[model samples]
Target: MANQSSRYPILCASFNQDNSGFAISTKDGFKIIDSNTGRLCYDRAVGAFIIVEMLYSSSLLAIVGAGEQPSLSPRRLCLFNTTTGAPLREMTFLTSILAVRLNRKRLVVVLQEKTYIYDSNSLSMLDTIDTVPNLKGLCAFSPSLEGCFLALPASTAKGAVLVYNVMELQLHCEIDAHRSPLAAIALSSNGKYIATASEQGTIIRVHLVSEATKSYSFRRGTCPSTIFSLSFAPSLQLPDILVATSSSGSVHIFSLGFETNQRTKMSGSFLGSILPYSVNDALDPAHHHVLHNAVSAGVRSYAVVRKVDKVADSSSSEIASCRSVLGCVLASELYLFIYFCVPFYLPYLYVRLPCPLPPFFYLLTSARS
Candidate 1:
């Protein structure tokens, strides 16, 4: 799921549950870097790795190897502590572990057809979910303890989703999202909303987790494109914005709050004529902002909305006094670009770091205010 077409030296990359820090796995070893200061927090020189997931800012890490060496098998998962530089525990599976997600309460390990849930503290097996064949391991997990829901593809034929409560260990609901199979999925910070994109990738839908129905739909493009990533702005209530990266090399920003507040007011205006809403509220083009050529076409890329800022603007009375400041990291074979953009305002490049080798994946830390 990290990269589809090109091969990068870095095997795997992932952020911690809260996105405060990220870990990268390379042929030589893996390293954890702080998202705030760009400091190297920890590094391990063992071998190549396929998955390296951190648990928040803690020293605990769940790592899977690339199967290059016998000790670092792809089917083996090691829970290692960075402070001691030694593994605390290990779990072997029948097949390769595709992905691992951790939070304060649960540990989720995903395989091609099965997903295992465990208690984080005691490491006791909690429950197991048998799912359809998921080669890419496409899923979304909300780390919030109150509404810690896990979303997985419900069907291989279409883009249906099954949302399960990880805390209560039961089924929540199912959402028939798209006719085509899903390409990417993401949950809101508080687990109130979930966003999905299908293989067609022409449209992205945002759904209410409780209702399990489409709440808002945004058009990605007229032509079919692959959605590399989808992220919701962190919020306890309804998130104001959602960000998406696509194979067409554009970073799309959808303003949900503005759309909601202005929908009634603009429905009878000229803006509504150009972008009319259907029964499902397919939003207008004005609300959809795109950053063109953010990454190389067809190269794997990921982006996240690290933070959103609200500022008072007396001159603008029709619009709300808020701005979505999106922090995105665009990576290709050569370098990683960390930049910020204010929708309807300006885009700014903060940091551009050249990679020692091709970076396979990268993630941004969330600063929830």
Candidate 2:
């Protein structure tokens, strides 16, 4: 049973084993909501901190975020038992955290300039990789559980991605990617395609470990919006790309497809855009005005909810089931906006929408009416 209150936005959400319930991180803390009861069975405040990124194993949850202070210091990592919101272990580091990923065997953490690998069983540090030039981002193990890859955005003269063999800590392949620092990196579940985006909205798709080399680009228009995040849906049945733009508070979804048995392409019209659904939309003018003003000034964050079954359908259909549903909600001031405020205001706020407005003549008739 899904939560009955469709009006409230979900801060963070993840599925459970039976696929019957979810562990949701909200402004309050963490809560386990029974899908059948639509009631929270467990809830607790892990800390006064906000969740920057979260990963879950079969019954464990790993959350990483900044400390309670405003500084460049590294964030703390906490592991919790999904069934009970109980803290299992906690660890601290030195540099700010960039990403966190938990595989079946190990937990990987990417800091300001280094990568740390840990033993998944004891949450103990197993080894560290600090030789890489500049570690920009981290992609956890694929859905197939083959291995994980590390993305190096920094190159002496060129931009490239360094694929690392997770178990051996050995460099696998270095491919010339882009001319500028990579803004986002993602790998398809099958490990067939690798996509990277830069400051500009230009997306580059490359065939991974293929000798018959081929690549393509998807122009996302002249929206000066930086791609802050990229993720490939973890479902093997429905392989799609999810891109988080710095501009509007929306997550863009694209279906991955292969053309002519060679090049890869991102197709399907604009899936669906998530926006803050104001709660005061139907309230009285005076009261609504106040609520609207408060909401506008408050921090807003959007989360994209993609049902695993939806992705599964794409594998069996020819036309590609492009049906996408969007869920939006407000986030606490600390997590959603504090750290990203400057970037969001300076670059994202001015991004132009993809659609064009009607001509002046078309507007005249509406004005007369």
Candidate 3:
């Protein structure tokens, strides 16, 4: 019998400080690969356990995971020097880490119901926030780092979303979002929009900070099964692009836009979907039945970043060229019996590009004054 529940490999990956390269956690160990060359720069065995989650802070890399055997001991979170793969610090807790993120100044870790903030330099716990209400999923922090937002399902009702302010540790607002639990949440690079996916595989969008007095919502698309993840484009030219991976090994993308009157609104224009060839199908033609299991169990992850370069302006060819570039990244993997049988696999797909244009530029152009 085929398993109805969808399961994809959850890889742990981090972007380099320059956003030029990426480090991915694999079954054998960890590897640092060149983004352009696709060549392995470094590969070493960390241990026998599969990494659960990872975060990059400056030159530091942190990984969290439990041992091969399932026990009551908490997952071990280890910090390492990315350049040499040297262990820096290791912390253990009874609760497993659900999410991990790093900003310029701090490393934030979200466990089951609590959030831990740590100093980027010392790796010491700076503060712990305990009162977050039923944190369903966490999204990227705002560009200013003033606050982080979370998606919470309505406790009493069916379709509801509760947005929380991480800094203030308060409920900012609530939206009657979807009929099912949220699968993933993503914040726009500009921090002006928020996108969410539900268990039923519906994508919805909302305005982060409003300029008008009204609120708005938009539908991105529906998935064949539950959506496991969501991401937005890093380029400023793109408002927000939504991506969702389904149980049937299909990936979908949506171009998102906003509509506003007195309230803000969201609309998801369907972009397209991709169904890549299964690895087993390419490797072994004799074992076709196994190919279905391989693809169905394979875990897929997606991320986007912007690449900018000066291009000659068509209207003013004599003048210096202006900036023009496009960015994208998408990857998937199947963890069959390959050398190692690590308990949990963490696969991450990351795209790195130059820093985007400042927010003030957009604000100035959109301002009414």
Candidate 4:
């Protein structure tokens, strides 16, 4: 199944830091789309590309090729300027680049065994960290300078993560999150919190950066599944919620700060009635809500918490309302689905992108703010 889907026309897709826009690379070339208007902002038909990352709403882009053409090698990274339609600078590496992340202050490039950090303004090499063999280039980064931290797997045998202070250029701490190797990791916008999911995908753990010994554990399910992504709500304090997408084609929302037991008891909503309430809820099933069959099971899906609001009710104390956009690629077609909810109501689809997307594609969302 993996090999067959690899032949899809669209190779990669990713949103910018703000989640206001997204870019996709394909066999024909690449294109950038505005999230608000769903308008094609930029299109280039030069060659096939494997990665196309945008810097916020600017004209600057970091792109890498699929190695189909000689000049468009996977080892070469190009800083492209859409305004001038020219390459500002290019960097070549020894091996294929697995992933690239950018913010206003820094640029990060991840290879199989090493990760490089560079000053985004001067393109000067800052530091390199030798990592355990990361074929998937598993890492998490926060773009905010105040909470700017980079997380990398400390060990391949277990879910130990090394958190580095990118701004200070020093090692922060290591967190042993899971018993098994990690499958997905996410960092909050302010860089104060980190979340991890092991290969088992049944339990997700959130850790405070300063206190690695303490963590908030959430049970996803009893049966193991593959977790594709994890995201935290954008906040200066502890995020109120966390979102996760898995191979089960279900999107899971876990309330971090909400009083689920009290809310479940007081509300008459449908979600409240069905939830199993207990005075001593160990797993806290009331706080965990799932949108079943959100996409086709086994299909790759990505979602992000774009914006969250606090609604004060005359009847209730407060309700944490959230809005998010999700994109999923099933077989040869690309589909975008938008979902948001207040309280425990099930998310309803709000928008679907016009069909017949460039064939063979994958979806990505801004993991942080």
Candidate 5:
């Protein structure tokens, strides 16, 4: 489909799990490229493609086409061999395919309000899921492909994240993440955690299913900024990182780790009041205040240490550096403003800085915002 130079062309894209290569689909065909060398690995003028995805095993690529009634139809879902431009499997369905996600174990196809999971090799239907109305066809496969997760709007409540375990066909948990519709959803590399952003895009909340704790909340900005993507930094080392890119032209990187200080703030008292203090942990005056902030904060990160844009503009023109504030307030009506709306400064300086910091030592600074 040669653009007559007037109409803009649209492309659908995705990267492989290992980040070795990426795949893109256009009206012309599907293409795969080596991410490292910028070399085209495979290209096929199969038909007009609407979506493309790669398997974690790097053995197959799945794509959805608009229609090739003569060769391939718009309803046909095709999986091709990555090494060779050979069609491995092709299936035609009745409805328009909204999205397709695959791992080493299974391939999931998303329809308007329904999802189907099939064996990658046999292409046999393993399970089918019913979603809320008008889901953006958003779903994710586990890191190991042992399970799957879907965040759908709650049938009863608006702006609720209905977490579903796609394998067992059960509801795992639900969180009232925001007042606005969800803009993006992400799963951690290990598949034990989930992160979500509201359509407003001012807040990011990470949910932990396996741990005793449930959620860690972070404020992305004072106002809404369109979030492009969120990802866990590839590492098996200390200080796990979660990076977020936005239309604001800033890349926010968060340094994450489990801290005993988080649990230091106790949940109980003589009258069961909302009082949090570091009783069990050492009370070094240096990291003392962080304990109060850690009562509800599970994932800890050093705040960005840059100038924040004070002028609220509908357009985000430049990038700003700001510290990642660590704060937690208990699940009570009294602390809602302190925990979620207001951003607190980091109590301690990150020993190893990931971003450039101000010349002044932030060690002794407090209440200076």
Candidate 6:
């Protein structure tokens, strides 16, 4: 049945750091699309490539034809100018490229059992590190232009995420995130937080890279579902807000807040004697808080979904049935709203959408800012 559905390998696609641009690759070809104007920045039906990624926040793109085409070997990687679709530089690898990630200063290429870091400009090799069997190509990069955080699997641990300082080439904190395979990994725009999900894709944990503290946890859904992506949106006034997209067709946004100054209390004094502080406060293992039955501020998440049914008309466009959702997460409460369409559009489509919705704190912001 699955073979009857798709004739070609599914196209690998991804968006840039700020969602301004996106890249898509299939055996048919490759193209970069602008998100704001809904236009193709560049299109190429040249090869049976399988991977396409944009250099963070830039128009530069990288494409890899690992195993999709045999005429071109699996090691060839091409960097192209998205504005003109001109090949800037091309390089070959010792093995197939499992995954490719780009920041402003560096490009990371992941193989099956090794990872390569390269200077984005010169495309020169910076360093190489061995890894455990990472078949899914699990990796993450901080969203900032000065991206220094790179999280990958540990070589010895079964399910540990090792954070590395790319510039210093030194090991940072390591989080024993899960015991099973990881479904997705994401780093905040400011590189202060890293969110991870296991293969179950139900529970997600956000950790402080410097302290390895589990600051926030989110349960995406009731039953197990495939997590499509996990992202940290930037905001000016928010603490930690994360967005997780899943195969369930819902975007789950989670916000986390902590008791301010708890860790930095000026040694409380009662009678000239100072209050006792725990020795393990810095790297204290967070009390395991699973998604189920966990308390959250205000509303947890709002989901936008397409109202389609088994008996729905096949000719109807899926976009015609999509409904947008709104949610607000306060310091102590979570509010969720699911409605039909926007105001003026109700006359045309009868949808109850928020025409100009108020800001819900800073669900999107750099952790550093």
**Higher-scoring candidate on lDDT, 4 or 5:** 4
| Worst 10 contiguous positions by lDDT, candidate 2 | 360-369
RMSD, model 2, all Cα superposed?
Answer: 14.0
For each candidate in turn, give its C-alpha RMSD to the true structure in angstroms: 4.7, 14.0, 14.1, 6.0, 13.9, 13.5
Off by over 4 Å in 4: 1-8, 236-239, 259-282, 313-369
lDDT per residue (tens digit) for residues 1-369 in model 6: 234214433356566766555665556776665543445677778766667888754668888884756744567778878677688988888988878888778888888898888888788898898878887788888746554788987743445798987777777878888776677788876788898988677777778887988765556655786666676655333334465655554556454422122334323434213433332222222221112211222222322211111122267633222112122211111111223211111222322233222122122211111
Q: Provide the global lDDT of candidate 1 against the true structure.
A: 0.78
Candidate 1 vs 4: which has more lDDT:
1
Writing each residue's lDDT as its tens digit, candidate 3 over 1-369 gives 123112323255544433345555544456555444444566666433334333322346666653543431236667767676677877777676666666556666767667777766777776676534444434445433554554444433344555555445556776655577566665554445566656666434444542311122333333335555555545354324344445554444443321121012111212112221222112221111110211243355443333433334377754232122233233334221111111101222222232222110010001111
Weakest 10 consecutive residues, lDDT, candidate 1?
360-369
lDDT of 2 by residue, 1-369 (tens): 013223333445443322244455544456554433344556566433334333432456666543544321237777767566566887877765666666566677877567888877877677776634444443434423464554444454454666555555666676776676565666554455666766564444444543314343444434555554454544445334333333333444444431221111211212112221121111112110000111122233332223323322446655343233222222322212111111110112222122121110000000111
Off by over 4 Å in 2: 1-42, 50-57, 69-75, 122-126, 131-143, 156-158, 204-206, 209-214, 234-246, 249-251, 258-369
For model 4, how does the per-residue alpha-carbon lDDT over 15-121 read when each residue is reduced to its tens digit? 78767777877687888877655567999999998889899999999999999999999999999999999999999999999889889999999899999999999
Give the C-alpha miss distance for residue 231 in model 2, angstroms.
2.1
Better-scoring candidate (TM-score), 4 or 5 = 4
Order of models, best TM-score first: 1, 4, 6, 5, 3, 2
Per-structure clash totals for the candidates? 0, 4, 18, 3, 12, 19
Per-candidate TM-scores read 0.87, 0.58, 0.60, 0.82, 0.64, 0.67
lDDT of 3 at 56: 26
Looking at candidate 6, the ten consecutive residues that score lowest on lDDT are 327-336
Question: Residue 266, candidate 3: how far off, in angstroms?
Answer: 14
lDDT of each: 0.78, 0.44, 0.44, 0.75, 0.52, 0.58
Candidate closest to the true structure, highest lDDT: 1
User: Could you tell me how far off, in angstroms, the CA of residue 195 lies in candidate 1 after the best superposition?
Assistant: 0.4
